[model samples]
Each structure stands twice: as C-alpha cells, then as structure tokens.
Target chain A: MTSCSGTVLLSRITAGIPHSAAYDDLPYTRGGAVDRDAVGALVQSAADGDAAAWKALVDGLSPLVWSVVRAHRLSDADAHEVYQTAWFRFAQHLDRIREPHKAGSWLASTARHECLKVIKSTRRLTPTDDPQVLDGISEDRTPEESLIESEEAAAEAERIRRMWQEFEELGDRCRELLRVLMASPPPSYQEVSGALGIAVGSIGPLRQRCLRRLRARLVARGVR
Target chain B: MNDNVGNDSFDEAAQDDALEEALRRAAAILDPVPAELRHLAVEAYALHSLRDLDARLAELTFDSLVDALPVRGADVPRMLTFSTGDLTVDIEVTAEGLTGQVLPPQPARIEILGTAQPTATGTVTADEMGRFLCDLLLTGPFALRLRTDEEVVVTEWLRV
Candidate 1:
C-alpha cells in the first residue's frame, strides 16, 4: 500500500497543484459536492490558454466523463480514448462554451455523445436503434470482477461487493440512471437529460424510481 | 388531500437522500476514476491554446452517414457538414485521410492538430476551388484550425 515519494510528487506535479492544503479552501467543494463557481473560474482561465487552470478543470471533471464512458460498457481501450477525446473536444469548444461553470455537464454530455457514436459505429447499429439493442455493451467486467476477487480481510469491501451485485441485477434503465449519477461531482439534471436524451423534467422522477428499486434490491440482499 | 400528498412526497425525499448517501460511497469504491485517464486529460490541456478564436463555429447540419448505403468490401467513409449562417465546410473522413471543401471556392489554410498532442500533426492549404486533402491522421482526437479571411475558426474536436 506504500507508494514511492517520486510517484506521489509526479502525480501532484502533473495535476498542477502545489503541495498545500489550498484545495480544501478552494470553492470547488461545497457541502461535500462540487461547486460550479470553482469550475467556472477554471474554465475561464483555461479557455484563455492557462495550462494550470486547464489542469484544474481536468482534475475536477474527469470523473464525470469517466462515468459517461463507462456507462456505455466500452472496452477499457475505447473508454481510455473516450476520456482523451472528450477533453479534446472540450478544449476546442472552450471558447464557445457559455455558462463556463456548467462545464461539467457539457463534458459529460460530450463524453456520452462520443460513447454513443463509438458504440453505434462499431456495432453497426443505426443511430435511431436503442442502445440496449446492441448486444448489451459487452459488459466487460473482468477488471471489476478481478478487483472484487482480490478484496482481502475487508468488511467494507465485502459490503460493496454485495451492493454491486444487487446493482447489476437492476433493470437496465435503473442501472444506467444510477451509474450516471454515481459520477463524482455529479452532473446537473439538465446535463443528464441532454446526455441520456431523456426529457429534462423526467430525471427527478426517474431518479426516484431507480433509487427506490435499488434500495429494495439491496434490502432484499440484507444490505440494511 | 394536498397536505397528505405533500407529506408523502416529503417522506420519499428523505429516503432518496439517504439512498444517495449510500450511492456516494458505493460509487467511490466501485468505479473510482482511473488515475492514468486524469493524467492524460491534464496533459492534453497543454497541447494547444484556443485563446484567440472565441467565436462559436457553425453547427453540423448534414452528415452522409445518415442512412448510409452499405458498400461491400469497402471501408465506410464518415462525412460531416458544419455550417455558420454564411459559411459551410464539408469533410469526408476515411482511414486513408480526410478530404474537405470550404464553400465558395476560396483559397485557405488549415492546421490539423491532434488535440492530445503537443503540436499540429499536419497542415494543408486549399486551392482556389476550396478543395484540400490532408495527410492521414493518427487514429485519435483531432481538430481543424482554419484561417479565414477575417479570423480563425476551429472545428469541434472529432474522432478520426
């Protein structure tokens, strides 16, 4: 569990944050959720070609993009490229991006769009065809399965495994909705609406339904 | 009746809040963001700057991929059309490279940048007919920075 100092230093250096407690004080985190103001300011600077500011934006929003790509059940390789291409598209569109603080939503939608395109073309499915019709996204769960298998002596890990098992059993729609919401610095309803091509007003009801379903399954499995 | 409905919804809201708390922890443990992906994205920020061209580019109005007729034994070419109120750029992308034409047949210069690379991968200039061909691009993220008469316009980054 011990990583070398050099690895830690390199990560900090690439992420463009000095070794300080400043992140805690930054306005990025609010009530344990991400604050849009912090992200908006970074977008402004990053659009103006400030590399450090861009790096900050990346650190903040990459998880949301990862969530979108993973939702498609892409191969790890495609998922990796999805992360790169989504940020690339964001960079190019940065100047045109209005409501800079909502960049997380924009990035998430773009990543989802990218995933849809990749999934469609590779599977030779029509754009109008339901995504679920494309062989169910290959489920490429080897990594997740292996990680669960490797859990040793950890009660919490065991609980998470149980929760995940229940998660996998939910209907596709519920699973997809919760997966998107699981993103760190979770996206706004408007963003999720655009990304999933669902009606804006429906997301809250959808979330409630999905969450209730998940809760029922977890409780049934004795997650308590 | 309204008050009863309100109370019922409030109870549901509290339960959703608690489920959210469980989800927060579960997502963190189950699908934590991969470190390498974050590093790649941060590194990409250093690739190029879009400081000068702030004006929004045109939206894509047409695509050849729509209802594409399958051609036997040939790779599919992805064709895209983007336009502003008065300008249009049509591009056809294939494994070989990209072929594009800017409207009204005017001479122009274009820079192809791999958005994740530190520099432009290739550059091409269109003739008076407004037609240009680019070198084969790396199979990843890319953007086209075109020099118009009045200013520069960058296309949305796309997969090639």
Candidate 2:
C-alpha cells in the first residue's frame, strides 16, 4: 500500500507554503493523514493563545463539523448559530476534554443538540388559534411530501449500505478505483490515474467498468 | 371503499415530486460559515489563551469530580453506585443507547460526565434493583457524578 504521507494540497494555487503544511491546512485531506495527537497539541496551543494553530484547526475541521450540522435538518440560520455557538462552547471547555481524540464526536453532539433545540422552539412558536398566524404559517401537510422524504433518505442509506456489501464482490483494482470515487470532491483524474498506474486516457473507461460491476452486484441483491 | 382506495393510490403516486421537493428544501437549510467568520474563530482562540491553564485544569477536575458521584434508584437498591473509589460502574448496554439514569437517595446534583471534550450528562437515579443506567452516544470510558443535598459523591471512572 502506498503511504498516505505528504501535505494535502487544497488548490492548484499555493500561497508558497510547504506541501505538508498546505496539505495539513486543507479540509479534504486524506482521513489517514490526520494525527489526533497533533490535533490535541494544536488545541492545547490554541487554548494557550496560539492564533495560527487555532486557525489551522478551524480550517481543517470546519467542513466535517458543518456536514454534521446539515445532517441534523437545521435551518440555515439555525445551523449557523449552532456552528458558531458550539465552537464558542468548545473553546470555553477545551482543558476539560480528557480524550482529545474524540473531539469530532463532541462537536457533532453539540451541533445536534443546538439544532434540535432550534427545531423545537420553532415548533412552539406556531399559533394555534390566531387566524392570521395560521394563514401565514400554514403549510399543507401533504401525505406525499412526508412519504417521499422518508423513502428517499431510507433508499439512499440502503443504497450506500448495499454498495459497500457489493464492493467486496469486485476484484482489487475495481475496489481501488471505486474507493477513489467515494472520496469527497473526488480525486482529480490525473491523481487517480497516477495512483493506480493506469494510462490517463484509460481512466474514464476503467471507472465506467468498475461502476458497472457495482451496479450488477446491487441488481443481484434485488436493489433498484 | 374500493374507489376511494384507488384514488388514494393515485394521489400518492402524484405526490412523489412534492416529497422530493420538501426533502430538497430541508437539505438546503445547512449553512456553513461565511469566509469572514474565520476571523472570529481566530480571535476566540486568542482570548482563550489569556486564562490560567491551571485554573482551567482545576475547574475540569472539579467537573469530573461532580460527574463521579452516584444517584440512587427507586426500584433497585444500590442500583446506581457512583463511587470515586471503585473506578468503575456496572451497567447493561444495547444498540439503541444507554437505557438508565441514576436515581439518587435524594435529588442530588448531577453534572456532565466523561472528559471535558465531548462531555455529556444525566441525572442520578437508581431503580428498585438498585440499578441506574444511562445510554451515552459515545462508547468508551467516562466519569460520573457525586450528588447529595448535603455533599456531592463522585466516582473515579466508569466504562460504557
């Protein structure tokens, strides 16, 4: 296996920083490259007033934290509030964290709590008797809308679940290619081609072939 | 009844797009930080640095101590034991989450448990079986609370 060492470059344009530092600075860096120990140290440093370390931590983990906020079904305004508030709370309690490695889960839970609170508050503000409020706030509770959201979320989750099961059905090369496809924002074609040692021209064809295998596997499992 | 059922099915089929749209609307609610908010995070970190590390550390230690005390349960006698000396709490766990709370002899003070990072809390209570159970989202070792109207009782640590 190739070592996942080196900096994750966030963009083609560099501000002239070292590659490792640039990679560490990017949000979408490879998962394996993240060092929890370093993150812990950085957090401690930030607690001690290190501005640069704090900025680096925020830049790197904001995307992951924000993704959790979105998944909680918070309104955009509410989500932003939760995101900002959670960070504030995190800063206040940094030294209290015993297991620094679990910072991700902490951020996730805090965001979820804030989102739920917002949703509940919004629910409470609905006027039960006022005719004007009813007219303004009234949304048709179509049975169809409820069913569709449930079905789609379930179907999407199931599809991803079955895709993993079928991934094991493919040969090693197909697995490797598909893994790259699953990566966030995905690797550039040149990067994927280089990693797999395949001709640049052939990369597209190989991807289609791998996806076909995946589809076939899912079809066999009776998944639409 | 048959005609009504048929009509309902048709309406359901027609409403598929409505559902998709609702889901899209819900998903659109996610709001990430604007580019300018980056500066706020920097400033917050700088302000955090001015506090005394030892003082902050001591507060954390006190927080953990509060978390270590046990609550008594109604049904279970000695069901929820929060003993700082034991360094462990015995509780049953399942896939759904932790299922019990500490019921103390009296309504004792309850504080958040686990490390300061990603910490969570529950009230202290024990069941008739002298059992208090809690389901935590994070699975691992955690600290508990000591609660009494008169004095707080904290445990050393417990694993879930």
User: What is the C-alpha DockQ of each candidate?
Assistant: 0.37, 0.10
* Model 1: CA > 4 A from native: A1-31, A48-52, A124-153, B1-15, B47-59, B66-74, B84-87, B134-138, B147-151
Query: Compared with the true structure, what per-residue lDDT tens digits does model 1 show for residues A46-142?
Result: 6666676776677667767877776676766677777788887777677678888788888878888778778766754223222332222123333
In model 2 chain A, the worst 10-residue window by lDDT is A1-10
Question: What tens digits encode model 1's per-residue C-alpha lDDT throughout B1-160?
Answer: 1346687788877887677656645555456566677887877665445334344465667755444664544577888877776767889988788999988677778878774453566889988888999857547777677776755666666664
Return the lDDT, model 1, position B73.
45
Q: How do the residues B1-160 of candidate 2 rate in per-residue lDDT, one tens digit apiece?
A: 1356587655643443233222222221212234444455444453346433322111122221124453343222212333333222334344444443333323434443543332346555554433454454534334445344444444433332
For all predicted structures, in order, the TM-scores are 0.73, 0.35
Q: Write the per-residue lDDT of candidate 2 for residues A1-224, one digit (tens) a residue.
A: 11111112222112232332212423343323334555666666555555665665666455445544444445445555566655655665666667665554455555555555555434432221223212221233332233236667546544433444465346757755554333322334543443344566886667666666666666788864
What lDDT would each prediction earn against the true structure? 0.66, 0.44
**Candidate 2: what lDDT?**
0.44
